[model samples]
Target chain A: MIAKQTNQKAWFMVLPVFLVVAFSAVIPLMTVVNYSVQDTFGNNVFTWVGMDWFKDLIHSERFHAAFLKQLMFSGIILLIEVPLGIMIALAMPKKGWGVPVCLISMALPLLIPWNVVGTIWQIFGRVDIGLLGHSLASLGFDYNYTQDPIAAWITLIIMDVWHWTSLVVLLCYAGLCSIPEAYYQAAKIDGASRWSVFRYIQLPKMQRVLLIAILLRFMDSFMIYTEPFVITGGGPGNSTTFMSIDLVKLAIGQFDLGPAAAMSLVYFLVILLLCWVFYTVMSNIGEESSNGGK
Target chain B: MNFNWMAWTAPTASFFGIIFCLLVIMTIWELKCPGGGPRIGILRFETTRGDRLFVSLLGSAFIHIFWLALFPGLSLYWALVFSCIYALAVFRWV
Candidate 1:
């Protein structure tokens, strides 16, 4: 291999990106940290309260409820979306005109803006004029997201599944496409059953993308705000209020900057920790497989 | 730079300063040592020095948060001690 010359000028190119990130992300994050520890009485007058807000947020029953509901929401979506996405990907046409059709349709939901998705579902699930709600109501199902907690939860879950499952499908399809034809030919030569081929061949190849899908879905679902906010408005007595919605309520509605900032920090940390764990565990599994089950 | 909009308190500024210092130190260490290659430790996963440092920092944050939650009356210095030990363990094993 040829030795490459070092280029000191590379830093100049990176400087622009570094500056942008510092301005956008680091500054806002510093502001949040600033708010987390201090009390304000309007007029930008602030008093240092140390970790009091964090302590209160840690023990707050409201926070606890939102957290549990957030966990449940994330868990439910992951459980549904991953397998559903895999199945859709596997069923997707591998070649010809069907490929573009499948790809375009799968990409459609993801291209929709989040709030538009929320609005789409809001109207779609309304019993008064919407198709789903009207059909369910006509079919004697008693489904009203605006009024019932269970209905609201179902609406939000379905909306999330519809919107995000495409992302998983796309990732899985890419993973599936990367598998060489030789592997499938060898499997066919061995007289492998469909289930065996899927279990031994398709699954192992899709593992990396599945990890990405799960992590993305997990993070997005955990921090869900717009859809539930638009659909249910976290109403029916805060039954559908997840942590982000609750944080927004605290920060904007009540203007409790200290506790809200504390909650935001904790929320950010929790997501970071969970994503780290998922990445570690999934990568470890990938390594074990690559090491021939050792 | 006029930074009044941030409402930066002394402690928060110091906290950010410490984080910035840590990042600088890490960068300097990387430049000096060159390769902080991945090593498998008690966590049974390959992690470089940078990864271990991240884990330790995140773990320390959790320790302080938990300490505040479980023992609100106690001084945070104990949590600091625990976090140091945790960081040491991560560096040594994870």
Candidate 2:
């Protein structure tokens, strides 16, 4: 059923969400803004600084590299996970016992904490002991993520793919399931090939969910840490450090509160900006889709 | 209370903030997804409200504590085994 059209009073249904998001997001955000504009000693005493931290952060090579690395990593993750997830989801059974088993198993990786996902892969890729590492080494390959830059990057990308592709799969599956059976019946009667049927029918139906999946994955991957931090510790030589990793190091490790806060606001803004763009684009598509149906 | 408005309060505040957000999410979810399971997925393996509360709390606790209590010499594989056992118990009994 279309969402209840009770004179927009239904927005009250969204009240719980707003309260939660505001608490989780707004307070910390206010603090981050406070820090970004000021310098402080060990005590609660604070001194006013201007845009100095933002200026310094903007010019920092380390921040630039981390930012570029995050952008690239997010791009790569989106490219790999979205299509692969769609393919796997397409292969899944629509009905019967297999459907549930497959969906739950795929989701298993996602339910694991992000830090643990990293640790699992860290162990899973150990050349001496990790399943992937040991298998590769036994098969006579020189594979060491700790020492090899390419291997480290590959391991991280693959680990991410394994962990998050299920989210895309579930979203796509929901979209697919929502397609009326009449569309398939119409296609069969019209003698449309299976490939044509999928391209014209299923893909269009899934666009909004896929857009959400892509956008969520992009933001999350761009800011990803905890896992990579546990696994690679942002090293061999800064190869795996994303923007979020750099932010944590600045804020907590070095205690450079001013610049860290600056970077974080920028970081959060970048995510918000991208999400807005994605939201608008998807809404347009939804509008067009509804228009088409009429 | 003399609230140390800057440092000591941030972590605790953030933690409680997460809980409050999650509670609101749970409530909205209960309204939206009434009659238990989400619109998609298996019902037999479905987590009830009690099980869901247990899983989220237990999982988060594991995230915080797993690094602390590992035996000094235990292998990563052993740790994984222990985690899998924990997941099983949460899944089956929680």
Candidate 3:
């Protein structure tokens, strides 16, 4: 697949993307790094703090708890959404009128704003007015997200699943759609079982898209803020608070800029590391499979 | 049996209702025009009409959500405006 000519002109085409990333990502990231190493006390006063913020953050119980909670949230979501999305994509109508119908319906949940998603679920899960809350209450379950940590976690998880599972479904559907008809025909000719067809044909073809889906979902969920902020406000006693929420409370709420900035860098590094690991592992598996097929 | 028309007035319910209506319209449109050849867009990937619609809808949702979150006291009319623009751009270019 290597190009016959090594052309440098391609860099010109990439300049816009590079510029946008520089301004939007790199500048703010540098500002965070600056803030992470300095102490500020109003009136434009500051003091150099070195790695003190990072040191304190590393030993902080709150940070550890939030980190663990964040991990758990992402873990649970990937577990539920990936398989669930694939199954839904599998069941989706493949042709004619059903294609658009299935796509539009599946895409509907994803279109709502994050906060609006929170608002919708907030109202939807209220004991007095929310349909879910009312039904659960009528069903004789003690489900109060406002007062119970377990209930709050469940609500947040369900809200996220409702909000994001569509992304996975859409990615998987695109992957499924891209699969050639010849594969199906060949499987039919060979008398392959349904599971075997999925395993050998569909799964292999979907590997690339699934990798993208997992990475996107992982990063988004790890940095999730607004929806949970709107729905539970990181409460029932900080039960649903993840790292981003904690960072915001530290930086904005208490104005602990140094520690918050340090935490942010750490958070960014963790995500980068994990995504790199995922990419390496998945691509290795892909290469191995292709080699084996040869 | 009497239907609950009042239930349809809620924002969430109305959102779902609008989605249902859109699905019906899209279904009819698909039935009328049965095929959509893939077109390459800005992403340099070939996408059919359904893929374009998915991207547009998803983009619109994010636009609206960000609007709501960033500007709490303001009305959603601006968000709607931005969303429409986004949808148009996505359909045309992506």
Error in Å for residue A56 of model 1: 0.8
What DockQ does every candidate get?
0.86, 0.05, 0.01
lDDT over C-alpha atoms for residue B29 of model 3: 75
Clashing pairs in 2: none
Check candidate 1 and list the clashing pairs: none
Docking class of 1: high
lDDT of 3 by residue, A1-294 (tens): 986876789889999998999789965776676677678886555677655676677768998899999999999999999999999999998999999998899899988989899999999989999999999999999999999999889999999999899999999999999999999999999999999999999998888899999999999999999989998999989898899999999999999887898889778777866886677567667767777878
Q: lDDT: which is higher, 2 or 3?
A: 3
Residue B88: error of model 2 in Å?
58
lDDT of 3 at A257: 82
Worst 10 residues of 2 chain B by lDDT: B38-47
For each candidate, give the TM-score of chain B: 0.93, 0.52, 0.77
List, residue by residue over B19-92, the lDDT tens digit for candidate 1: 88988998999898878867989877789999999999999999999999899999999999999999999989
State the local distance difference test value for candidate 2.
0.78
Backbone clashes for every candidate come to: 0, 0, 2
Task: Tell me the spans in candidate 1 whose CA falls farther than 4 Å from its real position.
Answer: A1-4
Q: TM-score for the second chain in candidate 1?
A: 0.93
TM-score of 1: 0.96
TM-score of each: 0.96, 0.72, 0.73
Best by TM-score: 1
Give the CA lDDT, 0 to 100, for residue A198 in model 1.
96
The per-residue C-alpha lDDT of model 3 at residue B33 equals 83
